[model samples]
Target: MKRAFVPPADALIAFETAARHGSFTRAAEELHLTQGAISKQVRQLEDRLGVELFRRVRQRIVLTDAGRLYLHEIRGPLLDLTAATRQVMSYAGSEDVLNLAVLPTFGTRWLAPRLGDFQKRFPKAGLNISVRLQPFDFGAEPFDGAIHHGDPVWAGAIAEPLFDEEMIPVASKVFRDRHDIATPADLVKAPRLQLSTRPLAWRQWFDQAGVAADTAFQGSRFDQFGMMSEAAINHLGAALLPKFFVRHELAAGRLIRLFDISIAQRSAYYFVYPENRTLRPVVSTFRNWLLEEARTERTDPETMLPS
Candidate 1:
């Protein structure tokens, strides 16, 4: 029988942090401990395990072969332990927090307002929202749940669709004043705001609308929809924006749809969680509530309109 193995949780934490960051100083900062303390704990772990975990490079630390092997052995368990502890603690508290990763625009305009009902029903369930850009990788990140738009085939996760997102061409009132975009030919003369790396948006929209323009519709490109929306609102150029993200702007007349043409995006928002994670009581509770909300959104019919 292998000797029963045991290590202090704190020491394991220190080792895991140091290994992940490759820096005792960074581990110390994260753990709120002195560098000497972190270093000592790591050294002790190595001594007890009878392995040289790391080598002292000129100034930086490099994982020794032993250290690399140990990290591979221990990293998964440590991360799982941390995640389980957090989920349990969240359940134990009066504030039931659901850490959600969402698209910035949709979280603000679509989900945030409606969350009030979720709070009312489960008053204890508090929501903590974080932003995730498109093409997010859930594997490497420490997110409990994510709302994104894409194919639902994330490596080891399950996706629940919220709704299909449609985009419409929009611009500030001021932009229309300066340009003659009465027709698609005229639109070519104006600037086209680009959002992220979605390359086929302009061509697809124009093609669907039975119109075409200078294939090189040019303007400033933005990595986030929020930035592109701002640029459009500021009279910079035309942006194909999702109605759900800018319902307020459209309702308040801050933005005007240049045309009623809407395109069904190949992707839509989804709520995804890792299939392998141990679902704690809190995680289950939050997941149940989110599914309920998605169902409500689907049936309400009225929610489909730009509010």
Candidate 2:
């Protein structure tokens, strides 16, 4: 295996601190080293990397273009390393931590609500969840598993089916009152909101509603479902959202169901983890628990529809 062009930790730290303060003297003070030692460390790093990290203008030190870019790249990894070290140091006993990356809305709306039950089932298994917009490298990121939405195919990972998307139309009561939304077809005429990720959502809903909406694809686009739901609440446009996302809003009457229309997306959500982690107790426990929850998930059809 080829070795990476990496410098010593002290050298990297010296460069980073110097870059932050724009002075070797300040960096030395922060690192509890002499100014000359700080200068030597930075010089060593620059020579090893074959890049000029700083250029002195008169008496003032300023980062070269390459220096600024390198600092930006390493700052995050450095912080992450420190955090990881601290996390390990804080471990009390045999308790294991399961790091997870999850779709933001899915985490907020679905997984979050059920986590209490997860804790009750396995009190010792600790979970650390971070919001993710899409699937990422399980090998690169420090994650035990992820909740994903797409096909059941991920490199170096096993995809376990969680649930399918159940979509419904929703609009603010004021927006509903303003528009003559008498039929499912009438929704095609009203202003609509779109989730940028799920471009086919509205079109699929219209097709299921037996409406020929050529412009179903046209609308105010949003990147997140949370934003789309809020836009609908404030009367931006009608939005097609998953039942999980708007359960509270629909119940609270903040957003009203437009009509008795629905659609199940072709793709479903999944619990994905690295292949080598299959036998790990935490991974298996969470996967089995989540799958059971998905199977039992149901929305009373009558309650979902307004009479």
Candidate 3:
């Protein structure tokens, strides 16, 4: 049995595009070629296939019956081929996916709520998240990027500022009612839930309030904010927590501010990514979106501090 001769893939692509668009000019524009180039390729395809692929109608082109049917058959395959080719090229140029390391508290309280918008925008990209403790070695980690507090200080990585963190004293309404804390001195007697990262949180809060608690005041300590927050909500005690971490809870009345005093921390959050040529697509989109979000939040009067 003799097999039919096959035409070049480029010719088939040109013909398919021309047939679908019904205009060589539009097809050429889409393929980044001249109209004459597209017409020539389509003509070559027609000659090779021995079929009239298009008909001239009042100085415009229309696909013939054969052309339409051929297109219907080849269009799906052509699109699939194009998508597959793009995927391969993307893999060659950049990472297959992005992995993000984040502090658990901020991830849950702040970043997690807003991740849907990022996914909606870049649904093709894959995102994997892990909870990170401080003083981590990036070289030892699989994370392509990290949302971290304070300076990243990691060599050979690009660090972009995400947002500043400010600490404030927060307690559950039930806890506050039970303790009846009216002044900084009163907070000393209250059980204080603490984060291991900020061991001196209670001391700092008390110092800012002009009252000194027994630096030895024993209370619960946790390695993560989510746990501490849950404890606070359960009325375990007051936690010296970040304002941003508890913004949603505070707004919802799940947690109430013990005092109006806020101390801007020396540490601020930064988005850190390894300095590599194979950039993850999601990282750029996320970074840009976060910067824009920060800008909007900075200008909004509701988020600003009183003059």
Q: Model-by-model lDDT, in order?
A: 0.78, 0.87, 0.77
Best-to-worst order by lDDT is 2, 1, 3
Clashing pairs in 2: none
Residue 273 displacement in candidate 2 (angstroms):
2.3
Q: Output the lDDT of residue 41, model 1.
A: 94
In candidate 1, position 298 carries an lDDT of 53
lDDT of 1 by residue, 1-307 (tens): 4434677878888988988898999999999999999999998888888888989898689999988888898888888887778766765646656777887777887888878877787787655577877545556775778887777767778887877777778888788778966665566768989876566777778887887665634678898788899999999998888767777788777888787677878977788888888775656877787777777655643223222
Which of the two, 1 or 3, has more lDDT? Answer: 1
- Which residue segments of model 2 deviate by more than 4 Å? 1-8, 24-59, 64-77, 86-94, 299-302
- In Å, residue 34's CA in model 2 sits off its true spot by 8.4
lDDT accuracy of residue 178 in candidate 3: 94
| Lowest lDDT block of 10, candidate 2 | 298-307
146-213: candidate 2 lDDT, tens digit per residue? 99898998889988887788888999889988987778888888999999988999999999988999
Off by over 4 Å in 3: 1-96, 134-142, 278-280, 296-307
Clashing pairs in 3: none
lDDT of 1 at 242: 77
Count of clashes in candidate 3: 0
